[model samples]
Target chain A: MDTNDYIVQVQDLYYRYDKENVLENINLSIKKGSFLAIVGPNGSGKSTLLKLMLGLIKPQQGLIRLFGQDINKFKEQHKIGFVSQKANSFNTGFPATVFEVVASGLTKKLGLFNFLRKTDHVKIKQAIESVGMGKFLDRNIGELSGGQQQRVFIARALVSEPELLILDEPTVGVDVQNVNSFYGMLETLNKEKGITLLLVTHDIGTISEKVTNVACLNKNMHFHGSAEEFEQLKINDVSEIYGHDVHVLTHDHHHHGGGHLHD
Target chain B: MISGLLQYEFLQNAFLTGMIIGVIAPLLGVFIVVRRLSLIADALSHVTLAGIAASLLLEKKFMIFSGLNPLYMGMAFSVGGSLFIEKLRTVYKHYQELAIPIILSGGIGLGVIFISLADGFNTDLFSYLFGSVSAVSRADLWTILIISILVIALVVLLYKELFLLSFDEEYARATGIAAKTLHFIFIIMVALVIAASMRIVGILLVSSLMTLPVAASIRFAKGFKQTIFFSILFGEVSVLGGLFLSYYLDLAPGGTIVMIAVLILVLAIWLKKRAATRSI
Candidate 1:
């Protein structure tokens, strides 16, 4: 909430896959308890940036600081939660229950060999309740719908009681109706629970409405500022980031209403 | 059945070994089937065949060969093959399944060469190829018992890490669970099972024993651990039934075991369909 509360800080970060450079000279800082959205077209370094922050991939150059220490040196992995794109990104037939999936969030805190404790159960219950998946705890994870699966993943991420939550395309395969509720639930977590949110998505139309800050990237950053600044962005700037003339009809009541399909 | 099991030492050894494989195969197999690495087990079994053939070819006629105990050498070869497959899969990335054919064909080809060089396929080799309870030595029993403990201990100690890596490797890595190390360990474990099982199930049917129980259990089991439990139950039935039928029917134990497992799989599928219809 305070400007001094910096949770993630990236300075002059550079990354390359083979010869092609991505995320060059990337500089950004995320404040604690704020929802930040990383938006750009395909091939942009948005996903790469998030991966660097989560230490999934190492940057070619520059420093990433999380909670004031070098990202590489930070060992409290449990304090951060990650949810990838909505394609499951896992073996679909894996026979784990929603409860088991959620319980895995404690892997870092509980370590590899120890069994889940009583307090772990309490946190798991709290997480499932938060995601409105309390009733489906015993159901197999693969049996759920896309939106329900996303909620279970969210619960899994939340069970660790993370200070920072990073999500990549969380609503990609989710139904249009469910996306609204999903974002609303995320908004509540940001507002009430004070969890810092970093989301990577291409859908600016939906997420721009709720995000506190927005960064538009295209191999390298094109724009970085608050959501209000992003809303007031020039059409040329948006077109440049997308590498084409882009038009998205702004819908004001879309977030408030039950559902709106934007195809 | 109790009297039948006690009447013969070979029967006793076969039955106990069957029970052990029954538990270990499906316990590991559930993860393998879900991970879609079942074919990898098949590839590794062929590699073990090559190893066994090589061991036989190298032994002199006057030297006196130990029948089933040579399987330890086969296990070492299979574990090496597993590591090689892991490396090939990593290097290829997109066409990772390419590793399967490469290993499978190479293994089978080398096995044929080794078998030819061994001069002749004797009654011992025939039993090994098709499965034989008559070849169960005390040393073989000790090896099975020791490998079973190692497999069980490995699974217990690394249960969460293994499960996490199998389902979502990226998430496992993100969570700092050492996914790559765990994956290598799992492949090695699968290799060990394949090597140890080659004598009982033979190269032709070892993968089936590892996979059929998993397929049957997944139809009705509600969760991951439950599926594993049901797979062990199904595997136990298949192994014991197949062993008894092999003895009574005078058929190859490996072929009979696989046939029984396949039958159970079909029954499980039919029952699942009936359950769905009734629910509707």
Candidate 2:
């Protein structure tokens, strides 16, 4: 693929918290319209990599490019929709309707001193509808279930009409039953809406089937390729990256029969 | 009370200032309460007290300073204290809440020093502490008006940015919303509002004006805009009712206003519990 086709590019990225290195010699490039899942064990710098890409934090050393432009120089932030981990990051009791929460997504695009126009209301409604939250537009955000709240947050991110959607451990507090539908919605967004998706998750087993691309990261980029090739990676290679023995089960079985680190 | 409000300039000044603050206090309070920075208002008000006490001492010592309004000095200290709190929050990121107590005690410590230096509490200081209906001068009203206009304008201009920042700060920063700059402006506006509110609410109880109405509003408000509307409504009721009751009953306006707010909050809680039980 051409370099311009890539939505995210990270070269020789290094991040450190004090003296210990969180990520080292990391390199990655995500093509446009690709559903890529970055999976890793606990404390494996998966979220850190997402944060760097979203410009939430600065890397100690490396080059990060968004849409082929240096991240530091990229001003088109509305082009990238980001939903951080839902649990513990927000005050659930905050008084806001789904429409209000989603409308706030256009804040940066609206710029300083600018109020929402009539056209913006239609867009906000459309965004909420896309996330299957059209009925919950007037409902209190705090009153929704965890899965519904997550969907409202996704709608919030989508209201900006972003070309790329990035989520960091998006299903933390979501119920096990709802997790499937949540992933389904994301899959639909990625495939049908054609939005570039970069999800940071630890549910490697369940998410592997939906994602078109996979990047197994632990401190450094261990593997970056098609999901099929990733599934073919030897268990020993995965164990080395996890720093522990991890058994991979190839079927739709619920139990993997191993002590897996779910982070 | 109506006739007295129009007949006396002091009453007019107090009423006008109280009405303006009634609107803006709870307007900004919705954001403050949602952000969980209610204590920051208490801390900043104490800092304003220190400034007021220092100004009183200076006025007693120098004739030239006697002509100056203590509101300006109080506002300066409140703004400075706000900036210091922000700095401390950055310095101790993990223990960010520590900033509130550190500044609160610092404010009281400085205020006590200034008060003692001026030979303890006098009639002038008494009004600043608990608020006096006749204490608000025409000049003080003008100061309050100017600050109210600035605060309202800033809130309108930065409403969307402020909403995003209060909702999810990290997400706001990720979207290049200039979080730091907007936050600085926000805290400074909080300081100004606290300072301006002192003439009606007094230093000791100014934070109650900012928070109590918001606390009540959160119980029933279904959306952000509704919360704002209810907060402002509660605030107006408290201020107007308190002012009228204070005039009729010869009570301290600040105490009366805060007590009214407390009653409203209690009513809201009771109503919310009733609704929940009914639903069950």
Q: How well is candidate 2 docked (DockQ)?
A: 0.87
Name the lDDT value of residue B14 in candidate 1. Answer: 84
Candidate 1 chain A lowest-lDDT run of ten: A254-263
Q: What is the alpha-carbon lDDT of model 1 when measured against the actual structure?
A: 0.84
Best by DockQ: 2
Give the RMSD in angstroms, all C-alphas superposed, for model 1: 2.6
Consecutive 10-residue window with the lowest summed lDDT within model 1 chain B: B60-69
i-RMS of candidate 2:
0.7
- In model 1, where do residues sit more than 4 Å from their true spots? A1-4, A234-237, A240-244, A250-263, B61-68
Residue A187 C-alpha lDDT in model 1: 99
Candidate 2 Cα errors over 4 Å, as ranges:
A234-236, A247-263
- Among these predictions, the greatest lDDT belongs to 2
RMSD of each: 2.6, 1.9
Q: What local lDDT score does residue A237 receive in model 1, on the 0 to 100 scale? A: 69
